[model samples]
Target: MTDDTVRELIARSNRLGADPRNTNYAGGNTSAEGTGIDPVTGESVELLWVKGSGGDLGTLTEAGLAVLRRDRLRALAEVYPGVDREDEMVAAFDYCLHGRGGAAPSIDTAMHGLVEAAHVDHLHPDSGIALATSADGEKLTEQCFGARVVWVPWRRPGFQLGLNIAAIRRENPEAIGCILGGHGITAWGDSSAECEANSLEIIRTATEFIEANGRPEPFGPAVDRYTALPAEQRRRRAAQLAPVIRGLASTDRRQVGHFDDSDPVLDFLAHAEHPRLATLGTSCPDHFLRTKIRPLVLDTAADAPLDEVVLRLRELHFAYREDYAAYYYRHATPDSPAMRGADPAIVLVPGIGMFSFGRDKQTARVAGEFYLNAIRVMRGAEAISRYTPIDEAEKFRIEYWPLEEAKLARMPEPKPLATRIALIAGAGSGIGRAIAARLAAEGACVVIADRDAEAAARVAGELGSTDVAVPVTVDVTDPATVRAAVDATVLAFGGIDLVVNNAGLSISKPLLDTTEDDWDRQHSVTARGSFLVSREVARAMIAQDFGGDIVYIVSKNAVFAGPSNLAHSAAKADQAHQVRLLATELGTYGIRVNGVNPDGVVRGSGLPAGGWRAQRAAVYGVEEQDLGAFYSQRTLLKRQVLPDHVADAVFVLTAGALSRTTGLHVPVDSGVAAAFLR
Candidate 1:
């Protein structure tokens, strides 16, 4: 019977979470209560089931719902002193758990306890918040909900909030729910089904009323349609601006992932009054925790030069940080913990879409998605009147609330490469793809750059992370394209941390037979391409004021002579020497340059199949089938070198295995004496 109730609660929770108009990610919570055996005491007790803190209602399960002893939970209200209850309430909630679930109950658990209902659902529905967060939202709530709803002014969520709800419920015995001013709505009933129905009805009625009362008009500055670029161009512009915004948001020097705003985001940015409106706080307190009370507004035109955009971003960032610092210090008490640095979580760029920053991909995506939802809510509210968020004092209280900060403090430790970003040249196939996959596995965001855009997309798809792996088309031989790719990577992920120059080609011809075209092509990719990619990426790394790594994929032919591989060998040798020169120059910037030399790997090396390997083998008087055997036997280790082996060598260099050992080469040929350094 308890299991059945938990299942129904989870189902209803997911139903509410499914729509953004209902709630943002993990922002809503639902609960059901029943008699159950306490896992700790082994006694039948009255239990209050509530959503655990940080659990997403959209995917809530039994484990995510914490069961507490009802009497113990309510008893906390009696023992608690009135001062600084926010932190005390959190401890009280933990103490009241009825079982060994161990998960902390939602901060709103006390309100659920005070309501005399079998089930309760609390949500930040757009219709409710649209009315609740407006200038005259309290008055509007009474007008829309009538006698069925009781309105409660905003207060920090804690035992104190529960007392307020309890007092309101006593006065309005027949009320279906309560509207939390500048916050959300709380609905209650004898069953989960009834509660869901009541919540939806209130939302529907409120939405209809808003639609009838509000008039839609263009609110933003008039955009010059003639100068406005296409949607694709706008998106590219957004990507390019992402890195600058991300750099400004990095208070701890750790790079953040960037999430581009949606199509609806463009509609919001297109408004004339957006400069003022976009910074006027979010729809509810929940949003403030993720997006901050207000976004940092940065404007750029659709056709703005890349350099100009970057400059404006830096200037705006300085201004935003200054303002945020002033705001933080003004509200901070001496007893308060050190204020977090003033890095904007959400950035509003007028001509392009908005961008959200987070320590990882998921958090960044959540902020971006929530801002898009806020845009919808604002549009609805603004259709009737201007958006008026909660007062700055209240916002400060919520933003600096001890309980909310505790949640972040409780987060799991980060991965080794958690805040790093990696860009790989020619990452669509073979060794490049393997290297990309490995880096991503270690928690770095991997940008796949390849001449084959489709293939890059395919490889990125296989990586299966939201913002971690992105595909960009890049032609290594073109200086303009190479520079643009580097910029695009910085825009997507703050700045480049490591770049693998794995894009190369071979010309199987003797010096006498090789044509000018063949020589130019080989040198174009090998010598010139490496130079361009390295130079452009190095600039980004230098600008970030942090050290990075560049790993070049050279060939054994750089050391050993091949029968007819003149052009390819010469180019390889050229880059191998270039690595030493680059390291000497880049070391002052903390940048490390290394080379991985691999020989005769059949699989995943972009080596031509069948007749190509046969022909190469015949150059050494070996049969096609015996080629692998011959190479393995010639090496002292007697092992066939695989693509993954070369990738591992690159990983070691990039992962700091050779932090002080730059300008060096690691041969992945199973110990070839001829290729060994003197």
Candidate 2:
């Protein structure tokens, strides 16, 4: 006879929507049962009943019950191989119960039969499903349940899973219940009421934890209106989503079985920052085996080609798999079983809810349920501290145990330009632009700041094409503008890596003919601008954990002596002194300050212009064409110096290759300064 308490518990499970059977959709399931052994004869007793397939728990009756002799069941388990021995055990139980025949047993009957408690029940609750869907789910579950709960990492159910539980029970007999990593849970007790109570207690704990910690703060005032599309638009968009889903699934004829546009869950997820969405992976590895780590969040209609979407998803999956394999090889033991394969357990379809793959419907349902719970738990825990998933190496060790050799084989490589952000002042043209472009190409996101707005925009546009250039128009001499540009660059790309102080003005005149205004114009952009920009960038670099590189574009006048060009020479010399002082002060912060002194570079063109050639020709008493030849022959390289030559020197100083060389002048004048000194 069916126990009244068992019937009531089943009724409550149905009311709460925990009845798996009735909830079967394209991807869902439910299961429940009662537990007991005969007290007097030590025989198996059917003290309670569970709803069978094709029936809802709310309407279940005694006919749905599958009974077995308690003592006979125990005896069969004592010699059974595990759930793998299901057919044999079932046949034996049927023969033993011939006098009182019943309907077919539930698929999990072997597992439930192994539980030693008097009462037991299991169900894949929706709430539980939502919490098992992210990277932080385990820690979140622990926080919610305290220390009493036993966490079973993802294992396929049936014989293997049952064996896993049996082994655990042997070690920790006091475990109140078991929480399967990418599945649901199993509760057991001495009576139907007590088992239900345990289930409810776990559920309550999970719910409270979610209520207290799981929800994300609303992404303050939806800045983008596309996030709040109307209902009709959402429907139209979902139709577009179908094709992408099909392509991601790699099934051309796949149809949408159900649509959930009104889902607040989808809306909230759609509005989340791109970074957060990119980082969302399944809560557990078992979920990885089925749903993969992340899903494709789509909003477009199902009829679109979806080829691009599918290709992107495949690329992400391949990357994740490669990362996982690398990690496995890093931390695995030489002989662990987890390192046996390279297949990923989950695949996240953008715009659609998670899709779980398994050997059959039951396995898929369990995986999906577990992923859902991971998501909810991770979302909750993010409210406390942003959930940063463990790196691929740590995850690899957990996923595969025999591949630790991979991580140990490689030497640690330093960053291409460690602790350096290169800012190119007056980067709109000539030497400044060339230096900025070269620095950015070398893995630094360059900040191009110039007084000319159009020139700045043009240079920025050119640099942006390569993804590492950011342009800002700022009059370098203005302290406010200099500070703003520095702040903006740091905000845009984390921190300052290097500073290329290339903004300066030049004028040729005798010392007696130079005016105060000429000196002021030259010094303001060269000496004062370089000093202020260096100070600001240096301050920012020191505030950051990593230090940086600073290079000043001084003139050859500071050393080899330019024609008594009063204004230019005086201003450049002052800038050289400022660079030395900066080098000393910023040394404590690991910032290296240096100078690049280039000679005869025309203001607009990197090469010497016609005017510059004529002037040089007059200085050396030769024709303009002969001047180029004259300078080219005088240099060790036998070639006129190009802006790129100066840029290359700037790169070496900024990059860590010359970490030990700082506060020194690097002249890219083809041994011209050496000739002068001689």
TM-score of each candidate?
0.90, 0.46
Q: What is the lDDT of candidate 1?
A: 0.80
Whole-model lDDT values for every prediction: 0.80, 0.57
- Residue-wise lDDT of candidate 1 within 138-157, one digit each (tens)? 78888887889888987767
Pairs in steric clash, model 1: 220-271, 220-272, 220-273, 221-271, 221-272, 243-491
Candidate 2 colliding pairs, count: 69
The 10-residue segment of model 1 with minimum total lDDT is 220-229
Clashes of each: 6, 69
lDDT of 1 at 373: 69
Task: Name the lDDT value of residue 471 in candidate 2.
Answer: 79
